[model samples]
Each structure stands twice: as C-alpha cells, then as structure tokens.
Target chain A: MTERGYAMPMRSQDTGRGAAVRSFLSKSPPAAGRSRLPKVLTGIEGFDLITMGGLPAGRPTLVCGGPGCGKTLFAMTCLVNGASQYGEPGVFMTFEENAEEVAANVASLGFDIAGLVAAKKLAVDYVRVERSEIEESGDYDLEGLFVRLDYAIKSIGAKRVVLDTLEALFSGLGNTAILRAELRRLFAWLKVRGVTAIITGERGDGALTRHGLEEYVSDCVILLDVVAHEQVVTRRLRVVKYRGSAHGTNEYPFLIDDQGISVLPITSAGLGHEIDEGIVSSGVPGLDAMLGHNGFYRGSSVLFSGGAGTGKTTFAGIFADAAARRGERCLYFAFEESPQQIVRNLRSTGIDLQPHIDAGLLRFEASRPSTYGYEMHLARMNRDIDAFDPEVVVVDPLSAFRGTPTEIHNTLMRMVDLLKARGVTALFTRLISTQELHSGTDQGISSLIDIWIVLTDLEIAGERTRGVHLVKARGMNHSSQVRQYQLWDGGIRVIAGAFSGHRKPSAAPVLIASGKPAAKPKKSAKKSRR
Target chain B: MNQSLDNDGAKPAGTAAHPRTHYNLRLYVAGQTAKSMAAIANLKALCEQHLVDQYSIEVIDLRENPQLAAGDQILAVPTLVRHLPPPLKRIIGDLSDSEKVLVGLDIRERAPS
Candidate 1:
C-alpha cells in the first residue's frame, strides 16, 4: 500500500498556520520531525520558486483550470522540461486531443515531440474513447486503459507522466460510479509505480475539478485561471495545496507566450539578499558632491522626484550612461518614450546613450504602460532583467505607473525588492506634484528609497529656473541647499550661486574636475564572470 | 380445426407465401469474459426464438483489435447493435433481461401471436 502522509521533518521555512493548513490540505500530515521531501523540478520559470522546488516527487499533482486556461500546455511544458532539462523521461497520455494535434499545437514552442519520442525520451499517447461505437451489456472496469498506460510507460522507462483532461472518460463511458472507483485505483497504482505525474482536470463550478478528481489526487493541486479585467486577460496560477513543501500561496500572474507558461510570483523575492556598502556614481559629479559622498550604495534604490521639464529622464539617462561608461551594464526602462525617442530627446543634454546601446552595454526597454496590464509589465521586466543581468537598472518617471498611491507603491516596492535581492543598484525617477514639492502623497517610495532627489522649477526674480534638492539621502551627510541647475545641449551642471538676483547666459560645459575614474571598488577578480 | 384449415387454404399458408426477413445483429465486447459470453448466449437464444432462421449475429472482441473501438464508438462491453430490419437499434448491459432485449431489437412483434 502507498504510504499516506509520508511524514518528513518540517524545515524552519515551513512554519506558520497557513502552511500547516496547506500541508494538511495536500494530505501530507506533518510529523513532528521528518526530513525534507524530495521534489521534481518542472524547470518552468517562477513555478519552481513558488513550488519550493517543484511538485512533490513521485506523486500526482492535479492541475485544474477552466477552458482555454492553458492546462494542457502547462502539463506539456512540464513534461518536456523534465525530459530535456532534468534528464527524466516522460509519458504524455492525453484523453481529449490526439497526439498529432498536441504535437502540432506545441510545435511553435519549439518542443521537438517527435524527436523526443524517436529518442525514447518521451512518449505521447492519445487515449481515444468514444460513446457511440461500443455498447455496454455487462459490468466492466477500465482495465484496458491501465494496460495501455502501463505499456506506454514501460516502453520508454518513463519517470514522468501526464494525463490531460481525463474527464472525457465520464462522457465516453457514461458510468461515473465505476469510473470514479477505477480512477481512485489508477491514482493509487500510479503512486505504486513511483512516477511523478500530472493530471489535468476541467474546472467545475463549486468543485475543484469537473469530475472531482481533486478528491483522489491530493498530493498537490494547482489552479490556473485566466481572469479578464477591462479588456486585458492575464493568466494566473495558484498552488491550492502542496504537501511536504512550503509553497508560495499567492495568485501569481502567469504568461503564456511562445514560451509555454511562466508564473511570476510577486512575493517570490525576499529582502534577505546580502547588502553591499560600496557606493557607485550618481553619474552627475555635482549630484555626487551634493550627496557629500561618492554616490548611492550599490544595490540600494535611488528615487529622483521631479516635475515635467525638471529633467528627470535626463538624469536617469546620464546615470545609465555613467554606469555603462564604467564598463558595467545598465538597463533603462522608459515608460513614456520609445527607445529612439528617449535617445533623441536625451541628446539635448549632451548625454551620449547611443554608443553604450550600440556597444551592448546599455539596453533600453521602452513601452507604454497602457499597452499591458500592470502584472504583465512586471513579468516582462523581470524576464528582461533576468536575461540582461544588468548591474544598474533605471526606471525613468515612476509616475507613468498610473495607479493609486498604494498600488504604485506596492509595485515599486516589489520591483525594488527584486532588484535589491539581485544586488543590482536601481534608480527610479518620479514626477512630483507642483503644489507640494516634498509631499509623501506625490512620492510614496520615500520610505523604501535609500536616496531621494527632488527637482523643481523655482519661480524667482520673475523667471522660472530649475532647482535640484537632495530631500532624503539615507546613511549619508548631504548638502541641504536647493542648488540651481540648467539643462542644455552641452550637459547638466549645478550653478553654485542661487538667489543672486542676476542670471547669466547659458555657460559652456564645465566638466567636473576631470579626475581619473574614481578608483575601482575592491571586489573579487572574477566578479561579473557570466 | 376444419375452419382454420379452410382459412389457411384461402391465405395460401403464411410461411409459404412470405419471404424470410433478415435480422443483422452485431455484439461488441472487450474480451471473452463471463459477462461477454453470457451476453452472447442470451442474445443467441433470443434471436433463435424471435428471428428464427432469419438473423445473423456478429461478435467483435475489442481486446484483439483495440483501435477498432474508436471506429465503432465502443465505450462499454457486451453491447448489441442491430443493423438490419430497417431502423438500427442498440442495447447496452449484459442483455440478461430477454424481454427488454427483444423490445430494444424491435423483435417483439415476432413473438407468438
């Protein structure tokens, strides 16, 4: 008999009543001092993180979702990832769609189903059952299905199996009583066989699965939902239950593009990543002087709050260029302007961003926030950041988030948390309201930020002149002076004399004492070995 | 008896004048299980009584040819399918109830009248 609730010592991470309830729901009763349960990595992005490794090893996981929710695709990707990445052979037995159709559907994903089959690493079987062809005149069990599945698994020595949409058996056989009992036995048999399995079921109203298969497969349960808000549809996955594991219980927004399924757990990141005390350039020597230090700490998030025409994006562009000039990578996420537009506009400030981009050191990701849902933008940003692995990230003008203060703060916090966890310095520019320059309502990230620089247009002597002030620079002594500044073609530099009652003509580029690049920080020689 | 003989002469005897009607039946089973064998025997007895020499029974075992199950839409075993005698019919289950089987195959009219 299969061991029920195989108790393992709970890890320190598995504390909390919610986790206990989840373990109980997943049917794994916590024994006082058991060891960690082994996990089978699905290799799907963000999925393994939320699953605390992957689905419980050698156990069945029921993936239930509504129509068009990409359940089959999720299962297929898991199988493929297992076979290709984890070196575990898988068997895909689909009851709803034929093997050929499934193969064709996932062809765009670049999954070589046929090649895997030919290599004996994967097997795809379409269990076809029809209601019209056969008449039942006697009591029967589903032994034929078991036989076929056994043959398929043994043919390839499969370690993973997927039964996609097994509800078709009910419609085909028209005998729920017998099928339900047999299904229970099948799940048990699968456990006995010791192959990690995924069983997809259609979501039912008021039930986890249409056929209540959730009752039988209780090791782990994942619910996939495609929710529509306004006109945008976002796919989300939540781990309803996970036995013998401490899983993230949040409804993570998932994306189904050419890539199969990527669950983006917003809370997957923690604030426990090691902190670095090393300071990096603010890109502007004057700003560095204002901070009374070399620059903001590496891995610390810097916020630049300014109104329109205060040159917020320009500041970010300069910072990005400076990082790139230091032979480090920087990523610029412009929500308001396209890459070319931002590049062209920043040229007015004499900031050469094109060369860094051309050199592949600076990458610009520009998109209108209105084009995608908030979570999609976050997911895409995370994906790009993961791929780019930049040392510095700049999000120009956080105001484009276009949400309530709390919502915007939450998003910014998550993004900053993610960046900080990766040990990457982040610079965010926000547009401050003109009425109140230092109001927290206008700039909610003041608490989460390590440095806050506010730019304003001070109307003095009947002329509008730009002013830059360091509002809050944590852990550093800085000048409290509201230094006057100018943004012109040459570059941006502070004008020392403020409120002098005399305004001079725009001066030529006064490059800060052209000293050799600040001595490089001491780090491991193999640092940044990608 | 004399009166019935005079009437039969006038009708030229029912069996001699009427052509034998054909009853084409097919039984689908997964394998040679006890229930499948019983269904076959039960169907044969019913056909002998009702269809006389006018019926032919075809038995299909799905175990040897599983792919054919999809072609015939076979989901359950021991299913009897009536193909001929116009208007096809089907009866599922063990076919233990001869009265229900006869009615399902539309052979009730062939009963002794």
Candidate 2:
C-alpha cells in the first residue's frame, strides 16, 4: 500500500490543483480497467475532489438551489475559473439578471468579468424573458436563442457555457410543450458543441429543479443547499447524480467568501496521515515530565479541557510561547479574548509573547465565534494556515463556538486532521462545565486527540488551588497522579509531588531555570524527581 | 366598407393636417423557415389592412446576422417588434391571430360596416 501510494498515476496533473487530488487518490482504490470520463476542473477548492475529477466533459450539469443559495455564483465561478485558470473561454447567458448585473454581482469576488470580456476570453449575453412584454400569437421556435449562443461561442471559441436559471423561460413562454422540446434540444445542442455547460435552476418543492430541468440535463446534477441551524447559515454542496463517475454523496459544507466558493470535503482527508516520531514540549517542563515521554508527539493534537477559569488559556499560551522560543512559527487563534488581552493576561503570569510576535515567530488571529458559521471559520482557518504555514497552531477555547455537540466535534476533527496531514502540531483548549468534567464528556473529540489534559480548580481545605491532571496520552506512560499547580507573577510552578490528600500542605517546588520561587514551600518532599 | 372609408378619409385629413403616425415594424426570423415566412406575410397583411401606405416593415434574418438577435433581446423566432410606437411592443410566434397582434401592438381597429 505504501508503494502504491506513490506509484498511482494522478488523474489531474494541472498545476495549482492542490492537495484535493493527492488526498482523494490516496484513499480510493485504483481504477483497474474501467475507463474514466474526461473532466474539466472548475478550480474551486475541494469541488474537484468530491466529483473525483470535475463535471463530465462536454455535458450540461444542472445546478439547482433555493433563492440566495449561491447557485448563480457557483455557475459564474466555474465560468470565470475556466476562462482564467484553465485557459478555456466561456459564455455566460443569463435569463434573469442582465449582463451588467451579472458582472457586478460577482465583482466583489474578484472575478474580472469585464476584463475577460475585453480580452475576448468571455462573453456574457443576457436573455430577458418578461412575460408582460412578450405576447404569444402562433407557432415559434427558440432558434433565436441558439443563434445568439452560437454567435457568442464562435466569437470567443468558448469551451464553457452557463445558462443561469433557464427556468425563467417557463414563465416567459406559456407553451410548455414547445418550451420543453426546445430546452431538450438546447441541452443536446450544447452537448454536441462539446462545451462543458452549467445550467442553473430554481429548486423545486420535491424535485431537484422547479421546472424539472433535471429531466433534460441527465449527465450530471449538483445540488446546492443553504441550511440555518441556530441562526447560523451554512451552505452545502452535494453531487446528487453523476452518470459516468463515482462522486462523494455527502453534503459537503461550502463557503462563499471574497475569494469565491470553497467546499470543505473534510471526510475525504480520511485517516491516512503520516505520523512523526519526534516529541514537542508541553511548554511547562513539569507538565512535560508528567507526560513521561517528555512531551507530545510531533504533529499530534492536544486537548486541554476544564471548567471556566481553570487556566486553559494559560497552558495554550505557554505552549505557543515555547514553540516560538524554539524559533518555530506559531499561530494563536484566540476566540475568547482579544490578542492584546491574551498577551497582557499572560504577561501577568510571566509569559511575555510580545517579543515573539515582534520577531515574527508568533501571530495571533482573534475573532468571535458568532462572526461566521462553523464552515466559514474552517475555510478562513484553512486559508490562514496555507498562507502562514505555521509549525504550531493554538486554538484557544474551542468551546466559544455555539453549535451542536456533533458540529463542534466534526469541525475539531477536521481541523486536527488538516494539521496532522501537514505535520503541524495543534493544541486546542475547550471549556467543560462542572457537570461535564465529572461526567467525562469532553466534546466527543477525545478520540482524535493524542494527548488530553484536564485542568481543575480544586478547593483544598478552603484554599482554591489549580490542579493539572493528565487524562490520557497516546503511546506514553503518563503520570496519573493529579498534581497541584500555582500561578504567580513569575510563572506557573508545578509543585514537586501529587496532591495525596485534600488536607495535605503544598509540596516543595522544583523551580525552573531563571525563575524565582514566588511562594515559600510549606514542606519539602524528598521524593522530588525532575 | 362605409366605416373603413370614413376612417381612411379621416386619416388622410389628419395626415395632411399633422405628421402621420407611420408604423415602423421589424420582423425577426431565423433561416426563412415556414413559420418565419408565415409571420412575414401575416404582418404585411395586417399592415396593409390597418395602415395602408403608412407602415414600413424591416425583416431581419438571424441566420444572416445572428448578432442582431442580442441587440433586440430576441429569443424566439418569428417575432414582430413595433419600433415606432411610443411604447415599444413585442409579439412572438407566426402572427396568425390578427386580433391578438392588434391588441398586443395597441392598434385601434375600425368597426365593421
């Protein structure tokens, strides 16, 4: 299998196609003898992977969705990408919005439709079909539309075409029989022209398209859906049917941002990440010693879960600071507080992150979880990671996100998988309620985590002391003893002994180098081990 | 016949007194098909019956000039567009029903004698 991983011939050899192909082909069994259809890659992120290659070549694909579900944007992205990235000129025939409206709508996405038009790489023809303006008298055919489309295609030598919402014709023309026959002919005509076309339709009540366009364009059907859960809107794409190819049947979450549409095919990453043998420190030397392996495995994911104010952020900040101290790039994603707040709060605990940030070794991204949906957050994070290429990533307090348990778990799992695949170490902090801490429910992402640390605020003899417990560390004989730790202006000091009982006084601390003991040791333990 | 003569007499006097409303019509067709020919003939007959010498028809074949179809936003073949009217109107199909075409173009018809 390892040999086959490298020996497999890649179906898409286009430059800048990115990891979608590599990750997809890594898990799928090789096609032995079956012939695969030729495809035109739509340069949208992760869309190609779900379709295996792309929309079937020289076939019309039906894209049906409800209002504001990004059906038109999806079609326009394909057309623009085909023209710009793939060097294939395209024609956009809009039956609803005019040419200027169509161009203006996608302008924010940075699609230079006007420039492409000026360069003769794209042609946009708006077909206005107003029922009020049109009066039907006798027999007529839709040959004029064909002529216009042909002219546009011939003028640019287009290989891609888009008819955005062909259902508008059904309302314009009352003769359903003639309209249906003409549409069937138009689809067949498009196929014969050898242009990969996208025909968008309004979603029907029960069917795929309002006008039943799925009946004519049977080659491929893609459904775009927008669902709102807890007032957070998420757009999803599903390959409803693909005639000649196997496609992902899952409803992959997609995002429409400034750069355009990007679908996150999270499950396609599978569990085939390469493991690293090296270990990274847990920031606090005492915590690293507690893990027995001296640290977490490189490229592994660590979860720090505890109730609110259990010093979860402090632990994450220390790990990030440690990573930056070693001259490694670290990205700190702060969800609960601002970057300045985190830096100032950590500064009070003797962790100065300003220097690392100034030295460009550390970067901070702070955004409230409600600013976007879960999928958008993932998409933005994916973009940031790609741009920064950090070695260590810190997502402080994943619990700030408001979603169902499964949503949070799935997002974290994907994030971990993404980091692992890139060989980047990730640390996530989650806030667990008091009940959940005793119940042992840690957001259900523990299986994906390589190391789990539970922080607790223990009241020992009327003294509220912080305790650090290593719940599980994969492939390591970690200490199971819950050790008490104290936070001081100097730094965190993991006292050199287990909390044997609630009444026991503090044990002596083995101070870190270049550190002073902020508190006097109540009693010295002779069993102190480094 | 008497009502038509009365309207024609009134039209010539109105034409002499002020500028006549010359009907400017354009018939869009593709490849001179049977429907296209029928539409052209029906449009000419309607113009002869309604406006005699006060109308002019320009037939544009999309097969010869497909680019022109986009200028007028034409999608269906055998379409008649009234260009000279204050409010432009479009009627698609072969123009078989003169009554619907007259109503669509807002043309006032003379009552039968």
TM-score of chain B of each: 0.74, 0.78
Clashes of each: 12, 0
DockQ of each: 0.22, 0.79
Worst ten in a row by lDDT for model 2 chain A: A521-530
Docking class of 2: medium
- Model 1: per-residue Cα lDDT over A401-428, one tens digit each: 7866776778888898778877899999
Query: Any runs in candidate 2 off by more than 4 Å, and if so which?
Result: A1-35, A355-361, A373-376, A489-491, A501-530, B1-19, B109-113
lDDT of 2 at A511: 35
Q: How well is candidate 2 docked (DockQ)?
A: 0.79
For model 2, name the residue pairs that clash.
Answer: none
